[model samples]
Target: MDKDISEITDKWKNMNQTHIDTDEKIGPYLDKYFMKYKKTIYDSALSLFYALDTRNLRKSHKHEPISIQALKCFKDFVDRNQATIEEAFLEQKVILPACQFAIYRESETWISTICKYYHVESLPKADRIRLLQKTVNEKKFSSAAWFAIYAKVIREFNLQDIYVPLICQTRISVVEQLMKQDPAIAQDVVACMDKYIDNAGELASFARDIPGANFCLLNDKGIAKFAKRLAREYKVPIQICPRIDYNAKMNAIKFLFRRRYEQRKPMDKRTWETMIDSVFDLDSPASEDNNLVLELIYDLTNYQQYEEARRLAHLHRIPENKWPKLLLSNRSSPDRPLSRLGSGKIISDRNPKLVSVEPEKYSVDLPDDKIFYINSHEKFKEMNSYITKHPLLAIDTEWKPKLGLLNECNPKAALVQIACQDRIFVVDAVELCRDSEWATFVNAIINNPNLIKLGFSIHNDLRAISELIADMNIETKPESFIDYAQFHKSLVQAFKIPLPDYPASSGGLSKLAYTVLGKYLVKDDQYTNWAMRPLTTDKIIYAATDAYVLLEIHEKLESWCQERAINYEVLMKALLKKDSTKNKVNIK
Candidate 1:
């Protein structure tokens, strides 16, 4: 181990030295450290190199004592030791910051060295341009060097036509950095980009690749021109990546702001008129019968144009039926045909049905009062009265735990839905905190051991809820509870129940509910903004059903356990003693 550590340290020192080092020599060091102390040493070295490089850059700038002769000497040293530098950079021996510095300071040299070292005689023109642009803009390389590289690639590869596409996809910071260093090169690249790639979609994709390409600022005239060009170049119904599309739209908006800021002029009358027309054109009219309005709302919402989104949503009454389909459609591709059809009809492979079961309907009567939206004392009193009357509460939470700020670490729970025998209460936890009475009422339900709190995998929900209320000085009892998962697993094992053919491990409480109770629960609103005001009917229904289905599932599982003479107490005890330690084995 000592020998291994010494060898690793020596290799690192050689790599970081002023002169270049050989990969053959450094290889053993990298292998030893990466193999021995993979995460710790590697990460620490990378971080240290980054900080040192930044410090060096700042120091070099401050102490301009180094003459042109010294600079040339340093350049000569780099050139002479090019092989070692190239090896170190390629092997990632220099760490990220130093590597970035090398890319910025000596991109052409690095690229040439890398190509030669790898025996890659030629690279795709677009890739070459991308690399050059990334190095120039991202690493703050000189404009002269950037243009020199750009010109050489274009001339050597005969890539004049593709230059615009490359430029369009190049980062704006690179452009700005190049312009700051040398405006002539920046102007040339901009001109090249403007000359080619006339289509909006292509332009959008290009802008998407570029760090700061804005698509939203393309005025009516610009869009009309691009749209016309796109029609000529590509087929109708163009497919685009949603993330890229979103970025392009954002960029366009930024472009508008930039135009206003730089040009110091208001939008022209024609442009203003076109903006209104374009927005309206994007909206669905009664005659079209399409959810164009909804699309517009989605676009506006995504762009954070809250007022415009709300206005369009209201104007269209954005039918709830269309929203889910539209949202899913935007995210995923239309299904492809399966080899065999259940009905025995040989379906075409081009367009297959993306089948998802329609959510099941429930007949439980809920109060007309919008308890989810309003944080009122009266609403809390009414909800508390309802819960007390039917104290046997079935609780569930609908939250995108993975989507929260903390994500894997500390996830926030929202929309704590509780169902009694008949009524279902979709409580907005976000709003509930605002009302002191609502908080008090929720605390009562959480603390009451006599309530018989039932849920499938209620442990997670309990943990999350406890963490949330911990700030309020409310201590929740972790002991008194029932877990449906443990109970169901026990019954399945005891009876040797036939498992379904689907992926065994993937199915959780929802699948268990479907298998046991023969009911489908809606999970659509599970990821929705449960904290949003004016909770929709769909959200309410989805939330309520989650808790309600758990109640039914628990009852069914319990009865099945009893019938099979499964030890319910043992199962409960096993669940209670279940190891919280992630890597530890559960002895129970």
Candidate 2:
């Protein structure tokens, strides 16, 4: 029998060498040989050897997609031989050695098959003793080999009945050697055991026996669930220490686990308790553990379980001083002030360094019949003159709402409208430039210190204008203006005012107008050629209304602030600070 086995092994080895060296199709040859010696150890070993050879060769180019035909053939062979393989193990024939080689070669597939056939009753005590002895003798197998065998055993037999003792004994014998050679593999094995096993006492005994096994594999959700389970099982409180680095990943896993388990119906609670207790027994708390705590608090806050979050915070002894900053949630509003310091009353006593200025004055003299284009240099001059006359101008711009390309170049800036008391002048930049009388108006508005600019998101217009006229100086002062969108947002939050659903960052002038004024302004010519020589009446009206609405919105928001005694300087400062972060704009 030994001589015959040696001859078969040599033939198989030569065949493998030939397959490696030549490009001949080897699948048919393997199938023919495997079928010819169906029940023998020779057949089993040859089948496993061929399958592993094929798989390894393919794995060398692992990224390439696997051939479906080859996979199907391999899977079919495993399925057909599964019962025979298990029977061979039970009979302790020459097939046992072949089974060991099969496990090492196609570890994943063989383990999966074994797991499916695992039945304690089917395995007679004599066979079990023989298999155990084989496992002990082959204990020098690689970690990958052990992992494969362990996985199969766990899957095949009831873990409570068979796997626990076997794994414990295996670890006792090989853990020290495994740890010495590859500490990470040892740690991963311990973690896997901690996660799946259900006996805390057994796990603790194992860990105590194996020194430096300090890490637990429980994720955040696992930790929470495990902590709760331990409290119920042991009738004692278990403090869960957050391992922050791993918490997020663990939380994701726990969520998936809960979802899967719930779908599967009632699980064993005792099993769950054991698993949780075993995993968490390795935890130790640290000061940097606030992120996980914060995440938990945030989740609780989402569910409006504020009291529970607060209690957890207190019990954890988290610093109370940082609570306000950590716990506070920012709500979005359409016209919410972008500045953090740009809301509330101008307290003269507290913030004396902050400056307050009235809106710049400007006069409008364009005839109603004449049309003006927004981007015209001449129109800018006339508007500048009007602003100079009044020294306080309500500056605003008009552009296509959704057209990105048009807004990028020669953007129409119509209705350089000036408001003084009840009078509003729409200084048409295009029409005024045709007469060359707009330059003085433009100069006056540009040069005036007392002419404070007022608009919503005026920084954009300022930038646009700066690009249009190379030397134009728009007052970039943080306190020299009022951004109505930003002011309104702060007002909404501070006064608990109801706001529409929109991103906190989205506070376009048009949206603000629609929300605050209940009237929709037209922008028919917004996407029209702004640089076109002829301007339409509809376009002029659209441009004019853009600025006109700003003057109105500004007055209403200002009055609203005054009525509430809100400090405008503080609000502006907050907004200015926020804006500063955005563009690195110098506010001085």
Candidate 3:
């Protein structure tokens, strides 16, 4: 054991270092060289990095100067190999630094790049889109043509579900062109506006960044049809006026509606009201605009109970009222032909057995769309369409009834209910008492010799109506206004029909209804306060029911006359000609 020390020492010696110890030798030498000339080496390495790595150099020397020669050389390299670099970018060069070296010179290049990027199959769709987003962030494009391309690409990539309003924002204007080229894109544009704007947001906010307003969206045949559809879909003030050939069919202006959020619940009454109000924007509607409001509402409430709602054959009757006795023809417009329905709607069409056995059933059985509360001029204007569409009207007046005989302060008819074939308008007598325009329109409509107006005990009502309409100084009553009371009397006498329980119109509209149609007007409330603002729902229902029932009563009485082989039109004319003082009727 003691003799092994020499062997161990020899073995250790034989395993000695044959190669140079590079780490040991070089450590101090490098330290001595770099320590002596450290600044020069550091500067040289940094300069090389600045020349080669323009990205990081740009970051570090953002406010400082770099080598101009290096920059020039790099620019020269990019310029000389521009095509090669872009081609490489095309061939799946996923490196973004190569992109920066290439396309960030200006935004038009970015726009061009985004359009070209759509076809670069080498890169994945997501990556191409990411690059597009980077470019988009650099500059937002305001070119309509570029927007149209996006409208195309959006469908191509099927990104429509993500950007609905933006799709509607961009695609609506260019839909006709896009449709002919790629029907999928045009239809998608239409589909993008599938949901009602529904108080999504205010118009000003939606138009926050109108991309290409300076450009005309479209001015062709498609635009009117497109604008009409948009009018059905519009909300913003920009949408209120789609100025084209107003007569060139109905067109809707493409308004950029920015969605606030996708509300996924039923709206409250107020919200629902606002939504309907916006869609039926009437005050600034186009001169030749379709009766879009009535048409749409008719559809919404087009139930079996109110089958008359579907009576608008073309939804094309509004502007036709400019001529009270406009000749019915197979063609109204030069290019597009129009026709009238063979059997026009009448009060009989609205007769749906609406009367209830239960006395407490208070509602008028009318959808909110069927009732127009015309408190403002806007609402009055909205009703003008219905007025034009259906000249035959049923009318009634509501006044704050004199509480006592000493009440010398004569209350004007607080409101007047005008019931046409399909809708009821409650005109605010108080609000419009001084509006000369309102008086003039009312005068013209009432005096339209061809119109057939129906009312019960209308003598006092016509006088009240004239007084309420301050300016026209209506010296005479409505020329064609027929008193339902006298008509019933004429029907009973001329046709020898059975006498009703209530013989006199003085018995009231309710008793008269009960006598004629078996559907008495429900007493809304015992205490009548008609002059109240925001008239109570019960009051509105009652008022509308009163006037609307006059038409119903007349329909039943006329049918009786027809059944009895009596000429109802001649009977009505005799009733209109006769005075209340002489309670006898003469149809000759």
Task: Tell me the TM-score of model 3.
Answer: 0.37
> In model 3, what is the error at residue 465, expressed in angstroms?
1.7
Q: Which lDDT tens digits does candidate 1 get at residues 1-588? A: 445545544444554453334334444444444335423432333443334344332222223211222223334434554544433223333232333433554444443333333223234456545555565455243432443343344333322223333334343444343334333444444334333333456656555555444566333346444333332222222122222222233344444323322232333323322333332324423232244455555654443444444444555566556554444344433212222212332322212233244324332345544324335668767788768666467877765333111002344566677777666777677766545654555556765645656677777787667655657766665434556656566556656755443222225666676567654443433434454556667667777767777767766666766776766555545554553212121322
Q: For each candidate, what is the lDDT?
A: 0.46, 0.42, 0.47
Which of the two, 1 or 2, has more lDDT? Answer: 1
Candidate 1 runs further than 4 Å off: 1-375, 385-391, 400-411, 438-443, 463-470, 499-506, 567-588
RMSD (CA, Å), candidate 2 to true, equals 25.6
Model 3 agreement with the true structure over 231-326: per-residue lDDT tens digits: 333322233333422322221111101010111212222323333333323565444345543443233232121222222322334443432231
Candidate 3 ranges beyond 4 A from true positions: 1-365, 405-407, 471-476, 499-506, 524-527, 577-584
lDDT of model number 3: 0.47
TM-score quality measure for candidate 1: 0.37
- Worst lDDT run of 10 residues, candidate 2, spans 400-409
Each prediction's number of clashing residue pairs: 8, 43, 5
